[model samples]
Target: MTQTAEAAAENLPARRESRAEKLLSWLIRGASPAASHLLLLPAAAWLLVFLLLPVACLLALSLATRGPYGTVVWSFTWANFGRALNPMYLPVLLRTAAYAGSATGLCLALGFPLAYYLSFYAGKRRETLLVMLMIPFWTSCLVAIYSWMIILGRHGLLNDLLGRLGLIQAPLPLLNNGFSVVLGLVYFYIPFMVLPLYGSLEKIPRAYLEAAYDLGASPAEAFLKVTLPLSLPGVFAGCLLTFVPCMGDFLTAEFLGGPRNFLIGNLIQNQFLMSQDWPFGAALTALLVLSLISGLYFYQRLEARQIEP
Candidate 1:
């Protein structure tokens, strides 16, 4: 009877331990799904609060009317959107598109070679080059744009250099023109273009090139067929990065471009700050956002098709 009682005492501890382990296991199992959702909640909430809410408000404002006192009126109206489509605004939109498109093309032309060199030929200096590329971003964009103003102004560095070199009789009208605006846009956005191209180019295996060479393909052929096709994703990404921001860049046009070179960004800014037409400005903003989203959707579909076997 004593031995039997001792065995029962030993079994009680084991049973308790088993129950504790089961409880822990069940807790972990049940909490895993909830924990994953909990982890996503902050990001979802941030998007909802910041991005979606502001866009919704902007959309609502776009649909409403502007009051005489430069305030938003809650009445429904399509006049704002209709005004945005007028012939006066079409030229601004076209010019904006032209500048952005030119910048994107120039970025691709300049950045692709640099990225290709960095990926294939930089060797141990790759990191240094990348660091140098990123150095411009360390400073404020406004400061950089202002610095360009100094360099490109009539009496500024370029003019002084030209004078010393006897290149021209007078300081060229370099600043406050379309040329300067495009140059500023290119300078500011080139790094964005390069990084994505580098990412794509670096991922192309050397073995693929070697295999192509073994099959009697020249370097140009290999690049044209293999490298270019594989790198389309990066090219599209770079274009989107460069183009979207360039389209909406008011500061570059404001400082570098004169009154004649104003783009959609400047127009929008004027509507809001100078004209105080909140409804029209909101309509313009909504249109720009929707257009960009539509372009992105089409690009994404194209990318998916390109990636498919």
Candidate 2:
């Protein structure tokens, strides 16, 4: 009787283990392929509703004709695209490109050193410094730009300071110019550049630098040969981030620039809001989007080629 009891007790644990395994298997099997795909439905719906739908509408509108009273007429037309490419708007496009390019270059020049320092020299204070860098983002961008306006304005704080220091007889004409617009773009986008660069620099191992030193390479040579090449990805990412948004931004030009500093963004805004020409505005927007996509595709191809063995 005792031997029988021992065998039953051993079989009881085996039965429990089998039951647990079956329960897990049943749970897994309950999530059918259809149900698994259903989990993606909400995200797919959101993209369709918010992103794809608007782009489709814009595309349709761009091909439609503008009515006599700014309403969109259903008649198909390519005049809007031609209007966007007209000589009148070409300068605005060029100016936008120049401003964005200058801002990107300045961001790269300024951000690289700051990122290098933060990644390599910050040590325990890295977190604190990064938080400080992010503090500007918490404030409203418009408010920050307005503050710059006050500072850069004639008879404002800068002028007052200069007067008190007896540096100049008159206040400098700092506001409502290309210089001010570029300043605002750089100020707003520098952090974007720095963050990417810091991410790239942080991933680089210190051992590589040590090895370079051991090979009797100078610091400059080591940096140019090893560090700079590895950090190109970050540089490209930062430039894209800064340039793309800067190209589309109108607020900086509106607030900090005068008539002469008008950009493509300003022209687009004027088309939709001031002129109420939705078709032309949509065409301009579509062109900008296509240009950006083409640039990104080329960049990706270049990156792929660089990565090939």
Off by over 4 Å in 1: 1-31
TM-score of decoy 2: 0.88
Report the poorest 10 consecutive residues by lDDT, candidate 1.
27-36
- Model 1 error, position 112 (Å): 0.3
Query: Candidates' TM-scores?
Result: 0.88, 0.88
- Tell me the whole-model lDDT of each prediction, alpha carbons only: 0.91, 0.88
Worst 10 residues of 2 by lDDT: 30-39
Give lDDT for model 2: 0.88
lDDT of 1 by residue, 141-259 (tens): 99999999899999999999999999999889999888999999999999989999999998999999999999999999999999999898899899899989998899999989988
